[model samples]
Target chain A: MLELEIAHNWPGFQLQLHLTIGAELIVLFGRSGAGKSLTLRAVAGLFHPASGRIILNGRVLLDTRSGINVPPQARRVGYVPQGYALFPHLTVFENVAYGLRSSSKEVHHRVMEWLDRVGLADLAGRRPHQLSGGQQQRVALARALAIQPDVLLLDEPLSALDAPTRSELQALIRTLQRQLNIPVLFVTHQLAEAVLLADRIAVLEGGRLLQVGLPKDVLHRPARPEVAHLVGVRNLLRGQVRGISPEGLRVWIGEREIRAHWDPAAPPPPAGADLLVCIRAERIALVRPDRLPPPERENLMEGEIIRESDYGLSQVLLFRVYGPRLTPERDYDLEIEIPPYVYERLGLDRIRRWTIAIRPESVHGIPCG
Target chain B: MDWFPLLLSAQVATLATAINLLLGIAVGWLLARRSFPIRDLVGALVTIPLVLPPTVLGYYLLVALGRTSPIGQALEALGVPLVFTWRGAVVAAAVSSLPLMIQSCRAAFEGVDPELEQVARTLGRSEWEVFWTITLPLAWRGILAGMILSFARALGDFGATLMVAGNIPGRTQTLAIAVYDAVQANDPTRAGILVALLSIFGILTLVAAQQLGRRLAA
Candidate 1:
């Protein structure tokens, strides 16, 4: 386990983060300038905070109160900085062997073993520039792990790779983490990457962690409205609870009473409690008149296509309900995203009036307080 | 024509360049990586030798290390006095050309990405190890350029060398002083030869420095 409690102050920004990571991967997810990189640097001992205590396994890496600040060289942590600052002058084999301390034969064996593990054994003789971006990233990972560090910290390591290579490396990382069984903190701003790789997601914005939970929970059930927006929950409507039953809870969104899914495992909120209904745009499905209407429990509403746009792979359609508005002040109620193929198959361009349905499971409710 | 002065100038420039490499790298790295109360002041002092007249620089060196000065007296007791000797010529040349070496070294060290050093440190290498393994290799081209420039400048140094080493016939007379001596004795043939040699050597070093600088930027 790795524990971090850091408070750093800058001229215009301040970062105060406290998190404990176990043997699983805990992704530090945030936007730019959200202090994700700084947090990783602090863990790596590259950035010193004003006050903090860092412990990995059973060792105290930093304790400001006791003034026991171990330097990065002795911290026993693997750090792969963004852009993989590999030794440009050294070959791949030498880069991996840099931190190993043993006899010459042992060093060579260890370096080659790591290179083989990363699938870069063939390129060991080549310099960093001779290899592609993905290959360099692998070399960097190998070099960091070669030290047998107690914890691993990666800062946007795969952001520069292509899609196929990224997914390949993601699998490689997962395998490595499981094999090592060490605390791994992966930093990224991409939600898809975070959801795919993280055992738990930690959301941060403006140098503050808004929420931390499982990917599914943070996605479908964000703790705060800001986190909902960050996780791509485009339709957040203000609502108040009207009633509760064994089936589900009823909430008033605008002038309409909509039934949203509340976690049955937890104590349900009382009636008249304010809530912010989180509805993912992709979850809102466009109902085709040619097919049978969806059951009433899955919210069925009549809305018109207020606007539509094409973004090559996907299309965004701004929808406005006809009867009562979900957001009365805005011109549009919900923004829906569908693939171009679906848009064409549905003949949505020619048709403006459409019925939309949202699953109860998709309509998540968070108490607004 | 005798070649004693030519051989002496080459020996002095080579020795001075070797000495400048160490001092230059130390001061240059310090200036590039460290900040202190008198950082700018120290930087200005390092550069002052370049902007000052060589004769004025030589006068200061003479006062600071001559037989009358404390350092010179200490060296005398140690039996290595520098007054009016070939070794004094080396000192004069080294001092005169140190600025070029330091400027090159400072720029080289600055050009190196600090991220590389930070990464190396995390990999269990000490600060000293990181400097030798990472920083030195990356900044070598710049330092080499500086050394070549320093050699050229030291080889051709006249005003400072003449002041401190005093242009003795066979001991302290370097190529530049030889050229002056030949001209004073109305021997244009010898003066022309030495002058041509110095000019060609200077041009070659400048060209080499320019090439290295371009490659460093690339």
Candidate 2:
């Protein structure tokens, strides 16, 4: 297990993170300059955090209050920085054996073992410049693992590879992490990569960790509108809580009323309090206007299809309330997504209007912050 | 033509190059990897030899190491006299050639990616190990070229060496000083031979430096 809570101030970006990781793969997902790489560097002891404690496997790597900061060499964390940082002068075998200098007798054996594990044993004699990008990545991983660290930190290792090679290495990294059972902290801005490899994902923005949870929870139930936007949810509507009950809250978006669920453990906002409602584009089901309206009191919106876009496997439809005044602050437009098959079967291209069914359970209420 | 100056020049240049090699690398690494309030001032001080007239530098050294000075008195008490001797030639040559050595070495050290050192540390290697195994190897090409340049520069140094060591036959007279003395004595043959040798050596070192620099860049 690895736990870190650090706050560092930079010129343009401040890094404020509080996180914990188990033996599973956890991805730090964020945009450029979001402090993902900085966080990884801090944990690896390359960058110092102003205040916080980092504990790895019950060892205190850093504690600012006690003025204890372990050097990078003593931290025992394997860090594969971006670009692999392979020694250009060293061969693959020597690179992997670099950290094994203490165990001189078994250095070669251990290095070969790791190279074989990464399926690069034959290329160990080649220098880093002679290998392809993916091959170099494998060599870097082999070198990092040779130290037998308690945790592995990878920084955008796949960002430099081609699409096919990236996916291949992504799967390889995931399999290696599980087989080794070492806590791994992977950093990337690509959400798809995070979703594919991470058992849990931590979302960051502007140097702050916005949310951290299982892939499904963070994707479907973001804690804020910004988190929802980053995770690709497009139908975020500003609303006010008109009524509250033990079951859910009734929110008013313009002239429409939508029911949203709030975690019961946390006290729900009082009635008439401002809030934000997040409905995923895919979750807003499209129902024919002539069909029977969803049971009474359910969340529904009747809107005209203003635009449509084809995205190969799926299609997106932009729907706006039929008779509402469109203003910069209160435009009641919701983006809905449907499969290409549904779009073709329903002849959505020819349809001018859509009745989107916003399921009560799908409408997530986020605090208006 | 007396051949003794040739041997003395070779010895002085060799010793000076060795001394410059150590001091150059130390100072170069310090400049490349550290930042302090006086860093710019220290850098300028190291580079003063590149721009200062050789005789002016020798004048300062002469004043500082004169018989009445504390350092010269201590050395004289220890039976090691520097003024008007071959050892003074070594000091003069080394000081005049130090800037070239340091510039090349500093550039080489700066060319090494810092990330490599960081990764080495994460791999459990101490700073010293990282320097020996990674930094020194990667920067060797530039350092080798720098050492050769310093050697060539020391071999041809005339003004500073003449000021401190004086033109003494079979002892302090380096190749450059010998050429001057031979010309003054109206012996064109001796001056031509000495000048030709220095020229050939200078060309060879320049070629080697260019080749090594190209390889380092590649």
> lDDT of each structure?
0.92, 0.89
Model 1, stretches more than 4 Å misplaced?
A243-245, A264-274, A288-296, A367-369
Q: How does the DockQ of candidate 1 come out? A: 0.80
C-alpha RMSD between model 2 and the true structure? 2.1
Q: What TM-score would you give candidate 2 relative to the actual structure?
A: 0.95
Best by lDDT: 1
- Candidate 2 segments whose C-alpha is farther than 4 A from its true place: A102-105, A245-247, A289-293, A296-298, A310-314, A324-332, A339-341
In candidate 2, position A141 carries an lDDT of 95
Candidate 2 docking class = high
lDDT of 1 by residue, A1-369 (tens): 999898988898989988999999999998989999999989889899989899988799988999988999999889999999999999999999999999999999999999999999999999999999899999999999999999999999999999999999999999999999999999999999999999999999887889999999898889999899889998888999988876588889989877788788889898899999999888989988676465666888888999988999999999999988889898999999999999999899899999898878888888987
**For model 2, what is the error of residue A367's alpha carbon versus the real structure, in angstroms, after optimal superposition?**
1.5
**How would you encode candidate 2's per-residue C-alpha lDDT over A9-104 as one tens digit per residue?**
878878898998999999999898899999899989999999999999999999999998999999888899999999999999999999886566
